[model samples]
Target: MADDSKSGGDLEKDQRSQEDAPPSSIYLISYPKIVFLYPTFLVAVVVAIFMSIAGESAQIGGNREHMAEVMSLIFLGVFGLNLTVLAFDFPRTTSLTLFFLGAALFMGAWMLLRFNPDIVPTITGLLKGLRPWANSQMYWLFASILGLIFIGVAISVRFDYWEVKGNELLHHHGFLSDLERFAAPNLKIDKEISDIFEYLLLRSGRLVLHPRNQPRAIVLDNVPFISRKEKQITRMLGALQVQVRPDNH
Candidate 1:
């Protein structure tokens, strides 16, 4: 009788413990949030393209034009140097790279002009583009498009985000608070080095989850501090598994 009573008491304790187990933490993960850079990059591309065109053809009034290959060379050099940026991972802002690149270009130009005085006329002509020119409103068009994209991305970022609960993965998106949930148990996580350049910039990477029941995987791109987040998810889920398991007794 005593044994039976003791067993009953133990059973009650276990039930209460299981019932009172706190919910596993909900982990919120978000993108690196560098969407504003899109406009900056677009502006750079436009400037580079225009610089090349300016070098190829000097424009005056509506119809006056002449060849100017010096501008083209500088444009090519700038574009080529920028491409090397892709070869290494860069940080969140490109200020350092841009600074270094500008310094290098300045030195190169100084050296060229110092050694070859004859090239001053060509360089002077290229410098002329910096002054006001006809058809200058084209720059305003680029600026407007850049502003629209900057505003659109800034607004969308607030609504679009990902989260991980012990049992499910959740995507909160759209202005309407639309939520999509996916089973997370037995969920396989993968971290991919999507772009070395991006990784170098912000230590960002693509994090993907394969749900046991879902045929397609959900992918989250440009997750900053990916390594830390991965460890956190693994630890959180492990604790959740322990909490949910039935007592062997």
Candidate 2:
């Protein structure tokens, strides 16, 4: 069966060629996906700066308590926006229950205020008791630390991160260049978008890579465009498997 022998030889040749071929794609994992925290931190810095400037005004001394109250409200509102799915998403029944509860409270408050105008002064007094102010040193410190952490993360990502190639996964780390490799083909991958606010910020989430025979899985968080990465890895691994599958001779 010369024909059969020739086909077998050709298949072996193709396998050799495919093995020698360069990787179809390479992925470098980095840490800039934590972009959402920047906006709020930057806003906090601005608020701190505003307080310092306004502190110099003659009217500011007299109204320091008022500024403190306003600052607290602003911080509360902005920070509340960061609650992600914890706030926006709820079970259908749960949402309806909360809606009804809120409606009832609003109606009760409306009726009370309508009949008892004296409550307005009491509510104002309660609000005026809250004084929250960030001193200049505190805001500057907050902004500085955040800036430093971001910079350090950037540099660390540039040098110490993970890489995916056509055949293997690479973990690049350390100043002295410690490196490890794991089989990428047949790698199990899981992607998670646990936080909706995070998804809205950068289309990012967590990617878990389960390499064969490895006791522990690798989880990379704040990965940007994670869905795209997962698809690319799937296609790459699928192609790799097809190319390497055993054929009956």
lDDT of 1 at 58: 62
Q: What is the lDDT of candidate 2?
A: 0.72
Provide backbone clash counts, one per model.
4, 0
What candidate 2 gets wrong by more than 4 Å, as runs, is 1-36, 48-72, 80-117, 120-123, 135-138, 242-249
Q: Which candidate is the best by lDDT?
A: 2
> Which residue pairs in candidate 1 collide?
89-200, 90-200, 90-201, 91-201
Best by TM-score: 2
For each candidate, the alpha-carbon lDDT, in order, equals 0.64, 0.72
Residue-level lDDT tens digits of model 1 in 1-249: 999999999999999977655445544445534442443455445654665566434654553643233433443454455455544455446646766898999999988876775788788567555433323244445456656776776576779887887687888888899999887767788888655555655666878888778888878877777876787788667776787899999
Pairs of colliding residues, candidate 2:
none
For each candidate, give its TM-score against the true structure: 0.50, 0.62
In model 2, how large is the Cα lDDT of residue 18? 84
Residue 77's lDDT within candidate 1 is: 57
